[model samples]
Target chain A: MATVEELKLRIRELENELIKSKQKQSDAEHHLRPKIDKMSAEVVDSNPYSRLMALKRMGIVQDYELLLFDYDKVELANMNRLFFQPHQAGLSKVEAAEHTLRNINPDVAFETHNYNITTMDNFTHFMNRISHGGLEEGKPVDLVLSCVDNFEARMAINTACNELGQIWMESGVSENAVSGHIQLIIPGETACFACAPPLVVAANIDEKTLKRDGVCAASLPTTMGVVAGLLVQNVLKYLLGFGTVSYYLGYNAMQDFFPSMAMKANPQCDDRHCRRQQDEYKKKEVERPKQEVVQEEEEVVHEDNEWGIELVSEVSEAELQDASGPVPDLPEGITVAYTIPEKDGASGETVEETDQSLEELMAQMRKM
Target chain B: MATVEELKLRIRELENELIKSKQKQSDAEHHLRPKIDKMSAEVVDSNPYSRLMALKRMGIVQDYELLLFDYDKVELANMNRLFFQPHQAGLSKVEAAEHTLRNINPDVAFETHNYNITTMDNFTHFMNRISHGGLEEGKPVDLVLSCVDNFEARMAINTACNELGQIWMESGVSENAVSGHIQLIIPGETACFACAPPLVVAANIDEKTLKRDGVCAASLPTTMGVVAGLLVQNVLKYLLGFGTVSYYLGYNAMQDFFPSMAMKANPQCDDRHCRRQQDEYKKKEVERPKQEVVQEEEEVVHEDNEWGIELVSEVSEAELQDASGPVPDLPEGITVAYTIPEKDGASGETVEETDQSLEELMAQMRKM
Candidate 1:
């Protein structure tokens, strides 16, 4: 039989659990950490391997898909070796990375160095070197995928991507013009901003978050991992020739701060020959090459600054196969097409997208 | 010549003055709104009326004070009319009576249908009637602050005082803890859990919110209005009230969410009270009065549960008053001679605080 002291202690323990369980109601000032053990049988019985397998077998392991393990139910320490902290049990980074790698195979690993971003270029340079320095010799392939948090970061990323032969994924977080987080470079696939015409930047860019995205003590890992991780996924895919290559992961991290992915087809795949063969083989009426889709659905098919892109629609699959009309004398480098309709004659209507050559765009705006 | 069409198309246009003058390099998502005219200023400008006046009058409103503001600021239009429509804004019995009589001196002519809370029987009857009737008398206060956004707002305020008389203040917002965007209710001191705990016995309870707060949203306006405007101010004063009262004339709403007075103290009156005085006072302190002092200290203290409350060399001037030591035949309140030794003591010595009745203390804990 338990003594009164033991009973009292148990009661106190229960009371503490209750206090923590009712964290939203508790007026005491303390961080609310949910009790991991003794909550429900479902979480208690399952291991991390099952979790990973569930998503993996589903074949839905797209970039930015978030899986939150509610640790409020089971004794985490009991499963820590299997589910979390396999690499390093006690350290915060190692513990975080271990859980992430085991469960989601989170591509981007966040290190909250707590250092100033301005003077903190050394680690960034080192990361760039690691990501870009190809393990092989002369026969370097197309590009590595990358992203950055802001213009300063983007500049750093762009410079690195240029060196590494990579493309950088643009982020809506950067729409707020925050200069903190930066991305690396990827090549071959068109860059996000390079394809889209700055729609998100115009849609967002609220005056309040003009200079910063969130609270002063904001940590980037929890939210932007998908963007960074997606970049990583693209890098691996470009390197390994994976099942399908998604150039743009259309994720709105700010909408809910959950890294969920959506695919954006490239806007510059205007070469009709690329579509004809793929369409015949794939048995689709017409198949726009991945690089030739519209940047954002909202933009008009044609814009004043057309940037050598044509409309995806208005041309039949047969028309694509014809390959007959004299190709419009377009710019020498890159070209894309939009599927969205134009108000006037389809030829003259214009659109603007979130992906901008900011230096050129800013120069044009400044002149205006 | 610039055409009239160009000039006619500008909506809310300002000159280049509206552009950000310099980059603010902080990270927080500092949420706020400003006077539309002040849009040219930084994202968040000062909301303190007292501070503005201090800058204008004396160049600083040097006082430590708590900050309190609701995320949902409502727009109210007021008059002496009764809200004949079920959903309308109007005046209370006293307010209607005053308007009907058109009394010159405020207290000169008054016939009140409202029961005075002076008598216990009357107070109980009043409370029961309101609760049983579901708290809406159809009688109006000065204004009805409705929440436009469906989001349930939360406001927690504390004043460094305990004893609150019958709440008799007009609120820009409503109270009584009804299940709505703006449910105003008095906190602990008046009509606590023992009397009018917020319970949704009569109304269809919102299970989601109930799950969040672990309680049904039931309430009384007597508590609500009392707590809404007047109580909120007191809460701010206590939370951010560094020195004392008696500061300005923005005095009320004229300053627009600014404190009129309560910035400075007689050089002698620090909140914990002068430490030297407390040391001297603790030796001869009594019990009941000490309890009273603890209640006052708590009333003035405002805090959010976001950060932990660290109570340390934390003896308040009031707590020190019960200083008389060694085998003193003390009352039920505080009898033990517990000095938080200027030097160190036992390992498990918790911070010294009020020894109040369990029932009374539990009532206070309900809010927690």
Candidate 2:
């Protein structure tokens, strides 16, 4: 049995130990909320990853809270399009978006890079340094997304992705803020940015130079949001392999037109890396196993011939030939042939059919 | 000559009054910083509306801060799609969004109405009360935006707008969350919401009932942003009379397709107010001057055909006749028809051509 004074001293020491333990538990929770386990879709305030986890619960993404976003600074204009708030007005966009994202789901591993993506050195450093863990295991970062505004930045991203033989997507909105486009680049498999330069570059005009003294390009949060949403949607599709991913998608908001087309990697691309990628793509095509072709049978379920009447097709060969020419008398406020001008010394059209064939062949192999 | 003690007392009293005045100034600033002057695009932290003011500088909007927005409660799931921040996790959506928007541009008028818009009385009272200022002399509110989620709210808004002859815009995202649409409604001039009910509403299914147990709709901030952008862009066009605003614009993210169509006020609409508007439109058309029709001349600029051959038109009467039927064998992943299923007792099709004629006549009158 201990004396009264000695027992009182032990009780005080135990209480101090309990206080230290409680502080340790709190510190652990503050630092490592989701570090211990996978994201949970619990609809509780304590669950930081509830929103992203909801994506999994909704069956949209297989693995929730796993996206790497690179944002630099949040301007006042960006507030309309992004989750950046007023209190975070002057903060780095990466930090602000990351803070919001973490609150959405802390399980998502978000790494930020605020360097200018337009510089070659910076681009290389970013691609290699950030993707060091994945690159070591032969797969580059699952996908690289280029949402940069300027041509130089796009070209830089294009070059880096080509050099690494990585898959990536590019998105942009027009200066008028009424249109936008998103395109996929599978290194050697698809057209690189240098393959067919945008009309702005082909017209020999710098996008930044187009801005007048006190006039900036019109931008809408709506266009940016749509583009971003589409970009992410395609990303999810590519990652989860569910829907048909558009190779190139364009948006004309004024008319609400979405035009899609696939581009072949230009053999005489300005970028040497693009040409090398094309060559590698060709070599791989030759090395792959013979692809099984699934013939689309023109089967008429109504084989009984109930009507006994042969109906001629709506469009004749002559009509089809006539339709091949440019359409005249477009409705008011509508324009046609808004295309990227061909590059000097480049073939007008070639290799697009071959690219499609190659894609089909890859699909067949995947099915096997 | 006053005594030294009296002078000292006066000085102390003045000092106390000055302190109170300083406190009042601070409080005034906290509550109303934008009530003083027009929105300024000054690039300063103190200026809350710089980004929106940039729109005026960019020549997009004549007045950057004059628009009104209504927001309600904010939720954790809303963080994925809106400007919800970490600190605003538990706050009402209206308060959080308003706090951020005011920070973006304090000049923009933001009014909050947290009650359910689907409630007929609440919607009517809300709309009437809010627009009393603008409706006093005949002109209704500049515009009303229905960003509510369900069909009941849409019908309620439509009824109120029709009753007041107010112009409004409707925006909605599809259940799959991959598509959305925005439409401009000019009350009497354009199609009312009841003219062509949405497929879901036409099916007579409750939107809230569509949700399964523990399952919520998948949404992206990108889509909502895009829709909002388009809505604001159209509002600017309608207010400033610059760009050609689409009456209806649909967005399909999966295929990056935008399908546009024009709907006219149905003469036999379920809503009696819509039928009255149509009758009024027809009466106005009769009262207006005859529109000058521009006949398309078949003038061949070239005396001789370039290829020494005649090119026959493709769309013959037979093809046109056949084209009206249901098209089979649409490209994979492309749905040919996305018709809004007709409601009970609704006509299959009627009065759309007349509506177009009315619109054309109105355009002609405006030109004259």
For model 1, how does the per-residue alpha-carbon lDDT over A1-368 read when each residue is reduced to its tens digit?
A: 54555545554555554444445333211221222332221211122122122212113223222112111221212121122211222334334543444333223232223222224565464344435343333332234333333434433444444344444444432321111122222332223332222322223333334333222212222223323333444343333332223323333221111111122222342223322332343342236555544442222112222121112222233433322222233211111111112223221101123344323332222232
lDDT (C-alpha, whole model) for all candidates: 0.26, 0.55
Candidate 2: count the clashes: 7
Indicate which candidate wins on TM-score.
Answer: 2
lDDT of each residue in B1-368, candidate 2, tens digit only: 54555555554565565555455434424543334365566654445454445445334343333323343555555656546654566566677766776765565565555566656566666666546634334335577887866677789888887877778889987544556788888666667787666444544556565545554444555566667666766665565443446677776554444555556665556788877777777676666565521111111011111211111112233432333344342221111111122223222111111236334532422332
lDDT of 1 by residue, B26-45 (tens): 11112111223221112221
Query: What shift in Å separates residue B161 of candidate 1 from its native position after superposition?
Result: 43
Clashes of 1: 74
